[model samples]
Target: MVEQQQSDDNQKNSEPGVKNSIKKLKNKFVPGFQYTLIIATGFNISMLVIGCLNVHKCPVNKNIPLFLIATGAIGIISKFTTYVRTRFSKHIQVVYFETSLYSVESIFFFLGSYWVYKYYKPSYDPTDGDVYCNKTAYLLAFIYLTFLYSLLLVMIFGCCCAFCCLLCLGSGEDTSKAGCKYSLLVAAICNFAMLVIGCLNVHKCPVNEKIPLYLIATGAIGLVSKFVSYFRRRISAHVQVVFFETSLYSVEAAFFFLGTFWVYKEYKPSFDPDEKDYCNETAYMFAFVHLTIYYCFIVFVAFVCCCIVCVAICVSATADTGVKYTLIIAAALNISVLVVGCLNVHKCPVNKNIPLFLIAVGGIGLMSKFISYIRERLSELVTVAHLESSLYSAEVVFCFLGSYWVFKEYQPSYDPFDETKYCNKTAYLFAFSYLIIHYTIALAVLLACCCFTLCCMICTYKVRTCCQDMVSVEQENDTGIQYTLITAAIFNFAMLVVGSLNVHKCPVNKNIPLFLIAIGAIGLVSKFVSYIRDRLSKHVRVSYIESALYSVETIFFFLGTYWVYKEFKPSYNPLDRTKYCNKTAYLFAFIYLTVHYTILIAMIFGCCCFVCCAMWMAKAENSRSYDVESQPTNTEAREALTTNDESEAKP
Candidate 1:
């Protein structure tokens, strides 16, 4: 009786485990979760639509176009798969569903793997001048385009590879792996073609123009990785990934990660729900930032090392050792500044607006330089006088002078004269362009000035540390350091009172939440700057708690300020737009932040819930859970035994 009762409980409990999961699935697929899923899926589909439209709009095969196309197609298919899995049959579906999911992921992985191999080019920003261009852009097309082209090639090849793997682990042993075998063949062919194209490009391009050829080779690698993975995976259900092979695979995957990101960066998406927008696109930006910063920092160090060697040669050649010593000391000073600027993003979070104005001035200088460089290259075609005058007062100053013109031309719906014409489904090809006019030159100027300041700080620090004991060097360092310190002190004071010297102004109208956020941030900056100014300090005018809390209250004060600003600014309305749901600008920012945080929380929670369920299931095994009637897919031997028992029985 006891044994029978225990057996019954075991069956009942175990049965509910599957039932709970099935029930959960039904709930998730049916209504609440389904709605959001559809929305997200639909959004991606819209982006795919835009991408497809754009591909035809400005077709180019170098790389970006294919990537956008592949991404759009893959994303739509993924969403479609979700819909099928949810609405379609449930049993034996997990394997098929998994296969589908893996297939989609493999496409991205393949694309990414090859992208990593693409030789990187310079960013769009004129500030990072590894390669100077005729134009400037916040969106670095060269870097981005190169990466995408690489990834697309990889993904195409990878899909073939995936097919091969699927066939190797064929749905049934009796069924032929024809589908996978064919895919393997195609992948192999594409890889060979890639090698051919790569070698061909090498000869076509000059040594200096080896960039184009390198990019092509990177693209080929992406395709090859896809081919290899597909062939191996198809043949073996559990292909043990060897370290040597895995390292090669890792390199392949890297191309996709790096390359796909560049493609994404170049996407000038319209307000298409399908595309990742300003807030959502931050993730892509971060990825680019990681790659670019790492790339720049490493390359710059190399450049600096080369420059140091040259400087040493220059010093050795100098007739006067005293002057040579002074020059070397100066060189050291410059090197220090570069180091410090690299450390904290040249203190970008500090004075931006003033730097912006300085950049505008610098823009004039660079415009002057570009025109002269071109004129020398193409002598007698363009005059120096017209070029020089055009730069000094022609571009940005005119725009600034015409601020009133902006107000006049501003259609309530759109900025009629908005310079940046980047957007939509057909945006990628177009997005690869640069603004050659004053904008680029001006932005570059600002960047250089900012760099100058950062360099100054770095040099100052180096002099103090490296020349602490040296008599003559110490004296020089003391003077230069004094000047740098004074300049920084003035800048920080200004920033605290307002914001970055580059673009800052105290707006009469303020959104409270943003203001509050700013206040809290500024307080932190103030404390940081104060610490930097003082070598050591113990005294406080007020208690730490009082001052800290006061800083936090700035946020509240700003909220109150905004409420007043809102009341006063009667005509200024954000919601009068014909298109776009006026979710309230500040409110939207907060909401966006909330949504991001919520997604993170939900993922963590979902993982925890899975762990809990698994643990509970493990404990339930204590009871006599074995049932004679239950047919488990535990082992082929057990199934064979059951078949033998059945055959022997003479029913």
Candidate 2:
């Protein structure tokens, strides 16, 4: 009996020890999971810095550095939001923000994966010519992707085991919790799998190129819609939001169905480096499975919708008028576009740009509709000024680059004998017209704004009575000007990317891109500093710093503008290319400089007008006060005027 008692005591002691160990493990795991993202973000920033510094030497794909910067920026922004929410606004939920950001990052990762892995084996030396990437950048990206997939597999296995255990041995509540977790895991896994397949590019098939773009656009729209819904509480209940989202998903589903058809039709077992139809068997099968899954999900959703409609009809329930009309309109438009694209898929054998044009048009229409919905239904709960500006900046850069590429590869007619010269005339014309219209409208608006500002200044000087009102107008206009400046800063970054790509090739002017990059970096940093200062304290003066940066930018703008103009040539002939500058880089640099010059002129005129008005008002107030004092004004009135003057001068 004594021996049994001793054994029981030992068992109880071991239980507490095991509990302590488990507690320690949980503590370590929790913090590790929390901080892993931050650590990865730091690594990403480091890679971006390194990539930028060695951009000229490395000649790495511009997309890689862009991806790094985008991911890093999102991570930093997320962390900032988390800090703000925790410290100042507990009412603000960050889950939606985080999820949207993660979705965007995942889309970027998919694109990056395609860019990096498509070259499976890239030359590290720049001298190896067009097919080279910086070794460090390439390996880091590869390893990060590999690690993510490995972690995903581990999570899948763990979730499966936990789910099985809960189903077999736990109570209903526990099983339900486990099931929720399992469903989330499954969704993540499926998303990752689809991304992997969509990014695979092993052949010259349009499906391979266009699938990624479709997936990216779908993800982007979804992220934006989620953001809108998150901020606008009423939007969550709105039928329009539901119809818009459903329409988007339906379009994606139909596109995926089309992709699956193409993939199956063009499947090949052998990989030939020289052949156009050289899809890897493994890659094709993976794409097939994922696309099939997507189509099946769409079918299932449609069936459910049909059943719901039937039940509603039986019960005499009525759908919202707006919802029904929106659904019909969206379905008609999306289906029409998809059917047209599918029918014309084979019309352009050499020019993939035709399909890109279709995709671009659809994307633009959807985005425009989404914007209209936001304008109509947006709540007053949150301001999306920065978000809108950021989107606009991205769109501007994308359109500009698309225009450049389209211009470069334009062919007037199809050539059966020469594959390089073959292009569908209709597609080329449509794309050209689309881009030209955009540029024409943009430039005209910019010129109109400049002319309006100039005219306003002239009128203000002539009519001194309106000086006070003009100053107030200018103050109100500050927000719009700030957005324009922000867009310019983003354009500067684009210029840097262009410069980096063309720097090595420009034998005559190697330092021009570098100079532009330096000035751009300085300008970007100045803007960031000004922003932080405004946020941290109202008393801090950033005008002097801003002035100095602007001065430098202006000086460089003139010098760079001169160099770009001097080096510009329209021809891309091999011999002429050696003598002239890269037309794309030079053209973008010129535009960047011109934008800065315009902003500088606007700022100068604005500041001058403000100062002149202030001086004129001060003189008038002095003259009026002197006259009042001469007339023997009461002491109380004089004291009141003195107090007002002091108050105005205090700042």
Candidate 3:
């Protein structure tokens, strides 16, 4: 019996040991972790070699590479320690080596890389600017350094995030929120610093425009993602967040490191450097185009990935049907524009009508979506209340001046001295389109729809009032106003496009009206779809619409302003004096130029209004949360408290 018991006990102990061995084996091969280990080892060995070489060359420069070697060695050791703990230890204790050491090592490596590349001349001739360094060797070295530093950044970010998660795990909701908020604050600081440094040194040796752009894009994306993550943490962050971030950093590291070597090969360095500007201009243009296109791609992919993860994981925070459908419509619209762009393949604005049309539509959509969202949330917003009034005032002024200018200049027949009827007719047609469209169609629709909708809503509210239930009569009114404003804005935007195109008399420009009409028709369909979705779905999110608008606004506003001020220079045009100087037509040109400046001013105000509205909305959300939490069961008491608080604050 004793012998049997001893054998049974031994078997029981061996079972757990076998399982533990299997677990350790499984942990050793975590896909990214093992790769990280290999990279770390390679980095440390290379740094040591580089340090020894530099020490042999110059005694003073020895310390620089030595510091880098020391820091990098520490990083490799820390990474190994991390692996050992993860694979073998039952209780994994968080250590400073894995977190702070990575940052310290990254800084040292970054400085060392810059110093070596900037000073070391592999092969160069004083007579002609030429570097005869083994191109492949330099390229490989650059790639290895960039990969190491980028890995360090990813490691730091992961460690910070994981630490926060661990601290917040099993804590109360408030504590978790605080931890995430603090994490975000730290991330923002680090990213902003990186951006500033990259910008200041972007034009120097070993630094380029791509570096600054990467930092700026990364910072923007991280801030937005972290904000969303803080509010809702249902997504498997380890899989989604880390994967996207790793992809982004990896692309940056590989592209930029290789790009630097390509630049070196293309623009050979001189041993005896001169103060002559001999940059390859094509390189700048190529960089500009690449960054512009790729930045948008990166941001959009990141946002959509996060949205998918959030929607899939967070049951309570589901995406609105309207948002999904809007994305589909936007994708179709963008694809159509891309097709047009590919077909045209020209330099002139008139030839690029489709892309310009896309821009105009995006701007209009953003403005309309923003108006609708704000109207729904805050009916008493000062900006919304005054938007129509300001627009009408501007319209009345434009109408009187425009009519006077046209009538004064117009002649019945072809009289060159007096403005020809044809030219006069086109001018009047373009100039007064807003007033005519607004007075005839928009005004009628606004009045009839507003009155009918209000009547229906009032009746619905009366029935709900009798039943002692909350009625959305006010919300219905907001929706009504939203539709009206969107229609009006689209009309104005279409007219602007038509008027602008008319200024250029190319035959291709004639097709612009047809394009505008088609886009407007598509807009109507989209609005209809949105309406139906809003009616059936509980919520509508227009963030994509907002993003599109921002792009349009920034591009058109800045570019148009610069074009008018520099390229067109209506004030200094010789043609304005010779071609249309017969009957005080210059006055009309002046008026038109004034309108451009006015539009610029309006864009500025729109930006300000957007910022203010965002702040107000955030405040309102927080206050509502507080109210709900404090007054969960007391309806009348909550109402009284809200009334008192509002009165006190307002008065």
Candidate 4:
């Protein structure tokens, strides 16, 4: 009798339409999650139908209503998948298939809802001349759809987290397996947040429809899959997830690159001969293009790394291996992007400093990835996580510093059509402050990482020094720690200088270069002298050569800045313009500025590469010892560092 009762219970559990405890409660209060979505979908479809029927009376294009219709259809399909999954939960294969379908549907629905809400929602002001405008009803529908859409995203992500937790509870404690789940959660949260914020402030946000709609569609679709993961948590379970994430990341990066390049390709290289004022230079268009491209790039990258926990979810490879591969792929994509960017940079609208800043960003990623590859091969001692965090921190610092300066220099007029108002102080200040604060926080985080890395390196070194065999290794590793410490100190010092100089005008133009020159000369001479002494002592050190190159590059950058300032004389006064320069001279100055900054940027980037590599390689070698076969010989390291330095010194 007990066996028969057990069989009956099992049969009941396996049957379709059976409710679990969670579902029972959910159904009683919420009218079924899937059913609610179906109802919401029906409401949206009704609204879209109304809009379409009155398209002739509406002032807007008919395409707007059609878009709403498509999105409504997507919502219906997504809800259908949800219903299937809920009803047939006992069928594992069906569950998996439905989950994938639901995820895709959710993506489409999210995008379609976002578009309709962003672009199609009518402004209900009664003063408007449009006769078909239903101000109150339309606003109410907009609010309802926006809420429903956001709730759908949040609920789906929440369900994934809940499911993951249940799985962990059912099995054993394994933290690594939970990473991709968290990544998805974070991505979904970000999307939801943006949706809320955008909807709340819909009237305030500006829309730029200049970017190719097709590319935008591709990017948006690719990015939506960022948070979705395979249900299986086996060794190979997350491989498909990684493939999709990385592939999408690459595609988004490609689109941004292409968009930036397209603008450059179309931009006229030379100023129009009939132009009246230098302030009205068409190059201002470059700033607008860059600004647009920047926002898109930032949005996509955010989708990829909303919080940047950087946890490895791919179980098939080592933790660092997965991360290294992701970064390597990203680097390759960035390189291709830079190649296109460089080819068109001459004509692209942007301040000379912006490209330089971009180069530094790209170079930082490439060097970090290369360091990871080398360390992995050599089996280095320091924890990959710690080192990566520190490196990322440094990259953030450099990025912010560059960003602040670029914004400071490239303030374009907001009103291109109005000739009288030549400057947009409000816009300039807004952009400058925003970029500055954004990077400042990033820099602070990086500085914290550097401090953490320092402590880790010291403690690890001390622990290893207790063993006699590790004494030499410790000494060698200390060089890298030293480099890191000095770099951090110098970075702090530079920031202080920037802060002080920015406060006072005379000090910045006069004192900053002199300060840099002094610092560079001292470091350059000391490193060169140390290199000579080390050679005489029958010891060869790559750090000295690397340091010397950085110093030289520093001097070159500062000197170039000064030279350009002195040579590129501009006349604000129309009366005595000939005394200072002609209109053609102004054009020449612009060209010179671009070329000059480009070379300086390249030199600085190269210097940073060699120094950072030298430091990372040095530390990584000491972090862990490897078999002599895979270990990089000191001679080889020196050769590689020197080769890079030499290349940097060239034009």
Candidate achieving the largest TM-score: 2
Q: Taking the tens digit of each residue's C-alpha lDDT, what string does model 3 give over 225-263?
A: 453444335445433343233223323333432343334
For residues 460-514, write the lDDT of model 2, one tens digit per residue: 5557555555576655565575676668658766765776577555666765665
Per-residue lDDT for 1-651 in model 4, tens only?
Answer: 999999999898777555576577765854466457667657756755764565333343333443344344434444544554455446422332333333333433434444444446565554565533454334544565568646655866675676677667756546655675566556555434433433333342112222333233333443254433433234344234432333234334434444454444334433343433211122225333444665676556534442232422333244555666676676675465345334433332334434434554554455455555544543454334323433443454344455445544564554545443333343334335545564465457445545655575577666665777656765776577556546644643553344344322222133333333333333433333343433333554333233323433333333334333533455534465243333332333245346645764474455446546755886788666655667888999999999999999996
Question: Candidate 1: where are CA atoms >4 Å away?
Answer: 1-187, 199-597, 612-616, 619-651
lDDT of 3 at 353: 27
Cα-based TM-score, every candidate: 0.22, 0.45, 0.29, 0.30
468: Cα error in model 3, Å: 14
Q: What is the lDDT of residue 73 in candidate 3?
A: 51
- How many backbone clashes are present in model 2? 0
- Rank candidates by TM-score, best first: 2, 4, 3, 1
Ranking by lDDT: 2, 4, 3, 1
Candidate 2 to truth, TM: 0.45
TM-score comparison, 2 vs 3, better candidate: 2
Candidate 2: residue 213 lDDT (0-100)? 42
